[model samples]
Target: MGEEEQEDEMVTCKTNREKEEKEDDAIATEAAAAAPYCYPTLRFDIPPYRSYHFYQQFRNASNPNNFLKSVNWSPDGSCFLTSSEDNTLRKFNLPDCVDTTQEDTCSSSLEDPYVADLIVNEGESVYDYCWYPYMSASDPTTCVFASTTRDHPIHLWDAITGQLRGTYRAYDAMDEITAAFSTAFNPSGTKIFGGYNKSLRIFDIHRPGRDFEQYSTLQGNKEGQPGIISAIAFCPSHTGMFATGSYSQTTAIYSENNMELLYLLHGQEGGVTHVQFSKDGNFLYTGGRKDPYILCWDIRNTVSIVYKLYRSSELTNQRILFDIEPSGRHLGTGGQVCCIFC
Candidate 1:
């Protein structure tokens, strides 16, 4: 029972411990090696109707700590803006986009550092927004965006410098801004269209301090049945074509000049939170709150079926539609796990 026996036992215990540790390390290494190579990591699949890449995900770091409510891409498609219920707007750079890859993380770069900045800090809820049209190359203004707040006002700012360019408030003729959900600029950047709770208003941004004109009134629905017009979008390619979606699951395209409803396509299963047109104005994208999906409508066809992504999944719930890239390359959805669909 002596000293030699004790030393032998101690040596055996140490060896066993080291062996077990090595085994654990080997298992971990194998799992890491086998982890799927998810490029873009935004869309589940790729190619044809499946190809998509992750641009980036963002969150609010200001007061109230609410999730983002809206987003818009720059006219040049180089940057995008995200507005939040917390009353702040953020601008993110749209760096060179890469196609989705099916390689493992180790084969490609694990992470690429693309950065976005906080350009404006308006102290109110930012419900809707849009980037201004770029008219001339020599224009000093890099980008322009409008943020509509609960205070019944629209604040325009130089997206690049965060300088306040103009403020459009409601007059007596126009009822108090019930809910401003979406904003848009005509292709030439001369006019601004805003969709509100009970009506739609257009502004002349070319002239500073100009008042907004009430273009059309949206049909209201019964309480708790979707009365609020939540989103609006102007067609980039179709000069006078615009679209509006509300909580009642209806998305209607209209003529910007006469405010005439051109067509109403119904596919949203929940509140139609937002709608967007592709750069060519061939397809209209709508975001649904109840079903929580992104629906693509073929504008050319009279009753084309809706193409949707992420139907009723956890990632799609409460996902609000923001802006699309100027080239119509990507659409941004706001939520805890914000998404960019190509």
Candidate 2:
């Protein structure tokens, strides 16, 4: 009960408080380590400068008019794949480091660090291509992409070596080869969904051959999406649902489990060319060939269009694709006018 006893009690309390603070700091560090990596938000107010650019490699002497058709980034963001008019798929790996603050400058093919690292030539023009949903550069086996080309079966190409890994063939009723207009890997990356004329085919990723389960998009009563399917996008939230855009100007949502038509979206001025689901998978955005507007629809309520995002498209038959950013707060798209809309 003296002054020394009281001072001893206060020292003990201080030590205990310091120990608890250290424990709290350790817990916070562990939690941060367990959290997934997040990409920094982009600033649009300031004009963005290009860190890398490439040209000359895409040129073809035999086909002087060859041009890039579409570019898709890998799921891991390690690289990107490009399809071109020359019936070739090229993979370009991103550099390990870049000086974003440096002034923008043009670089020739020889000087460009973003030159194509791998290229796979197809027999015909590519119709659609998509990276494996679970692709990771660290895993060699998972680094592959599926591409559909004219008059050719769906090819699973190795992203690292540019080799033909596998093929999924679909035969017509008369036992002839049938090519898919669009192809995409399911959320699990265990199956590939392919779109054909008034039909959809599901192929097992492991077993690559003519074997497939076909579903007629056009039902027996003729109450379904008609014409060739142009694009396929799966729900990002692993909801076992996907949206298909058709050349018939109809966008249809289907249940991945049974290929059941959930809803049909109509309003595209031309044939639908692209369909992407929001990161939350609650909304769907669709773009069409020669269509100036990208229609947004709420899957929860398909009765009315939620809104329309306009782009400079309407004149070209080429597919003008748009994508929702990872944060789902912004959407970016390229149009025929050579400008990107965000």
Candidate 3:
């Protein structure tokens, strides 16, 4: 009610607030001093990648709204290609790769976060992106990638300059264009293969449409012809062999020369979405829709799987991709909601 009383109350409230702030600061300082130092985060129990450091992060201002769709590593392990939903690819170079090396992949310095060195933008929304089987950042000509978009021609581009190198087009009997979901390059980089709804189309790089080969991977016509292929992985050893995984939970190895079905390894728990071969080309690893484990098979012996690498916990229809290290000892893959390494 009085001015003097109001002023005294205001001063007391200020004093209490300052006292609380000082107490909070003291508690935080004491907690920090009592905590123990943590070692650099790594997996010593793992084979080759016992030590992995978070070197950097990369962001692009050009396509801020698009989510990451796919990632493909270079053959030489120098750099990688990250594809976004906008039908664009970004090449994030590992600048410190020259002086460092890792047991599994080429190492980059733990300097400032790396930035996108080059951005390759195509006009259509990208369906799939694959690095040339022999891409190397050191050689500009060798730094190439293949991409496919729905209802659009498959284009191969120079990753360094983002220039269109070649286009592999497909036309139906009506002379209308056809769409594809997945693309791959032969180990020699002389041919391109695409996954259509029910078949895989092989194209010669020089003249894509002049003469092409088609192979059907559809196993069942009864289940509403769920014949769409999930992914394809080519053998890097040049053994004239490649593998195709489909929605029917079968992984088939095919002869590259005659396009003959060599062998079939079936009975996976889920629809095979992605397949990859080990560095030695002696084993194949596969991840499927709703599968909790990454299946590994010995190519030479198809009767039994070598092991099942554990992955994310859930039932998902999403197709996850996995990769093996250059040393052939470590394995990496992504799950529905997280990344897994085995």
Q: Which numbered prediction scores highest in lDDT against the true structure?
A: 2
- Quote each prediction's TM-score: 0.63, 0.84, 0.72
Q: Give the better candidate number (1 or 2) by lDDT.
A: 2
- TM-score result, candidate 2: 0.84
Model 2 collision count: 0
- Per-residue accuracy of model 3 over 1-342 as CA lDDT, tens digit each: 799999999999999999999999999999998998453455755665423332233334764555776677777888888876666678877777443453434244455445677887777877778888767667788888888877788888887787788888877678888866778888888889887766888898888553677766655553222466667889977798998887777788889888877888876788888888888789888888888988889989999888887888346676677776655667777775555464
Over 4 Å off, model 2? 1-45, 60-62, 99-102, 107-110, 338-342
Top TM-score prediction, candidate number: 2
Q: Cα lDDT of all candidates, in order?
A: 0.66, 0.88, 0.76
TM-score winner between candidates 1 and 3:
3
Looking at model 2, residue 15 earns an lDDT score of: 99
User: Could you arrange the candidates by TM-score from highest to lowest?
Assistant: 2, 3, 1
Clashing pairs in 2: none
Scored against the true structure, residue 211 in model 1 reaches a CA lDDT of 71
Model 1 C-alpha lDDT per residue in residues 14-51, reported as the tens digit of each score? 99999999999999999988996454434445634432
lDDT of 2 by residue, 1-342 (tens): 999999999999999999999999999999999998676667777765665555577775777788877889999999999888888888988878887766676542356555789989999989999999889999999999999988899999988888889999999989888899999998888999999999999999999998899999998999999999999999988888899999999999999887889999999999999999988889999999888899989999999999988888898998887777766677888885544344
